[model samples]
Target: MIEILKPTELPLARETGALVAGILQTLKARSVVGTNLLDIDRQAQAMIAEAGALSCYVDYAPSFGRGPFGHYICTSVNDAVLHGLPFDYELADGDLLSLDLAVSLGGIVADSAISFVVGDSPQPESVALIDATERALRAAIAAAGPGVHIGDLSHAIGKVLNAAGYEVNTEFGGHGVGSTMHQDPHVSNIGRPGRGYRLRPGLLLALEPWVMADTAKLVTDADGWTLRSATGCRTSHSEHTIAITDDGAEIMTLPKG
Candidate 1:
């Protein structure tokens, strides 16, 4: 469902968004070389519990995934892009890692994701892939406002990714998030403007723009969760929870510090 949150709830949404951002930032900072993916998940669990927030992923059993996620956060490495279930794997220098998180605080939910290099030795392709997703996310946010069509945001994001020489996968993209983690009004990475739902004030959307280094095709890992590039090429993903306003859009998932 497409939900336009009440003004009173915007503050709660902001709080949830900030919490999600802070957790991802903390995880990223501590994810140095030799850090295990399972350790990262444990840290996320502790932080969520300390913050008095509920994890949207732990009990999540969507059609695309097998059973409950049983994890607090998603840890995508290198070629892994979406629904990356945390496992027992140590991060190495120059590894591209993406952390996606969603949490509920004050009865409101917010979601976001970030991609960064694990260590000092960053690959040129990895840096470029991360940069493209970040740029696309920013463009999508800038295009969101009351009366603007969802397609406009998609177009803006698509232009950036396509120009960067990467293809987008529409199977999974951004979606509405408020009372629940995933809602209606699916926002694809690419589309034609002037189509789809019109943006409205108080509408919260998790605008994510992810791209693979080469092909758009995805292959699900044996874990039945992590989505990797068909050609095993590296990938990157960037996302933020934004609230549409009368004037424009306000990004709620930015790290305060």
Candidate 2:
């Protein structure tokens, strides 16, 4: 379902987006060497509850994942990428971690993700992978605006990843998001320009650009939710929920001071 926010509904969306961004920023800052994934989830729950918000993940059960995700946030480390279910593992120095979060506040939902290296140790490959995804996300956002095709955003993102020498995986990509966590108008990471759905004011889209270092193939972990690189290569993912407006695309998930 494609949900277009009326002018009156936009304020709530902005609030939800701010909350999502703030939680992600808080989680990213708290994640470090020896940090337990479960602890991170707990932190997210606390923040959501304190803000009178609802978690889009806690009871989320989709066909591709195990029923009732039963978590507050997605903690993807190293090889893990999408739908990363929080586990009992503790992060180590230099571990590549991606925090994906979504929350509903005032009846509107917002989603976002960030990839970073944990602790003081920084691995060159990990940094490169994260940087590439961030760059691709930026490119995709830049390509978004009124009348822009979904494929235009995809092409922009794909070009950045391809140029960086990483394989693009389209199995799971961005999508429309609003009142619910996930919605229609699937946005692939790679495609031809001037195709697919056309952008319009008040439309909200979550544009995520993710890539694997070596291959485009993915393998589901035993947990049935975590998606990892088939070759065990490091991966990275970046995402943001954007609202199309008359001026251009407004990034609703940016952190607020």
Write model 1 residue lDDT over 3-48, tens digit each, in one string. 8899989888888988999999999999999999999999999999
Instruction: Give model 2's TM-score versus the native structure.
Output: 0.98
lDDT of 2 by residue, 51-152 (tens): 999999999999989868999999999999998999999999999999999889988989999999999998999999999999999998888899999999
**Highest lDDT scorer:** 1
lDDT for 170 in candidate 1 is 91
The C-alpha TM-scores of every prediction are 0.99, 0.98
Name the 10 consecutive residues with the lowest summed lDDT in model 2.
3-12
What C-alpha lDDT values do all the predictions have? 0.95, 0.92
